[model samples]
Target: MNALPNIVDSETGQGLPRYDLRVENHGPSDLEFEIWQIPYNGTPDVKKPLRISGLRGRNLALIEHRVLRLLAKAGIHLGGLNIQDQARYALNEDQALNLGLLFRTLAPMRNRENMPMVADGIEAMGKEEAAYWLGMAMHRKYPRRVLMALRFLLIDPKARMKD
Candidate 1:
């Protein structure tokens, strides 16, 4: 059997059994903060939905590998599904809708490499097409921060910096 990866806690460096991330308000204000755990690889049969309180009372999907990585960095572990398993079962339509709303509100930052993918999916495409591809990527990654960055790109094509 393939051994699971040992994702260390960003702050503590302790090994984690599973990984999960939660969004909370940093202070009394509405600003959102991401709390995460270490990464692990396991079966998807035990995966569960992630609840983020600061996201306007919506539960965010947590089935993407990247999302797992982000969570691991913060010290979270999914109970059942590992990174690979999450990649297999991406988000559904309703999840995508919720993610879109979160993305619009969060407007987080992302890596530069992913910008092109977002651009290719949006430029010259109709609104429906743009939404579809963006939705697909969002479902696959479930990285709310990255999705928010992509949402910004979608809203303003020319605003994104060139790769």
Candidate 2:
């Protein structure tokens, strides 16, 4: 498990749950990766949503993967991710929301490298709403970039740059 530090929500006065990046080997060549939320008491939260879009089992991996990709495409490359290794980092809600907002305005054009001429239909979206769009992008599998986006979301703004 690769853990990231917890950040407190300013309004709630409660720290958010720590998150860890985990990868499971499902087959000889198939690897599944996910971001697991670790609440206080140092235990992993195992409550998987019963249903997502009528799908029996769906996880945060899909949306998170897209988020990472969107950030990367926007020229904010949070590097040093190794699919075979596990490491810890730190990320807060504000950071996530900011990244989402960045993607919202600069979201790439449909199935092409260029961006839209005008930011149409783009509005301020909270984290949950942003997540919904991420899932929708994953579900529709459109824009081509969504599916082709990176499959990891391991980023730490505080980490020291490696030489």
Writing each residue's lDDT as its tens digit, candidate 2 over 114-145 gives: 22111112223457755655455445746345
Which stretches in model 2 have alpha-carbon errors above 4 Å?
1-6, 22-33, 41-78, 81-83, 94-124, 130-163
Can you write out model 1's per-residue Cα lDDT over 65-124, one digit (the tens) per residue?
333443455445554443323211223223333333334433332434443344334334
Candidate 1 regions exceeding 4 Å error are 1-26, 30-46, 51-101, 104-106, 110-135, 139-153, 156-163
Which candidate number maximizes TM-score? 2
Query: What are the clash counts of all predictions, listed in order?
Result: 16, 1
Model 2 earns a TM-score of: 0.32
The CA lDDT at 142 in model 2 is 68
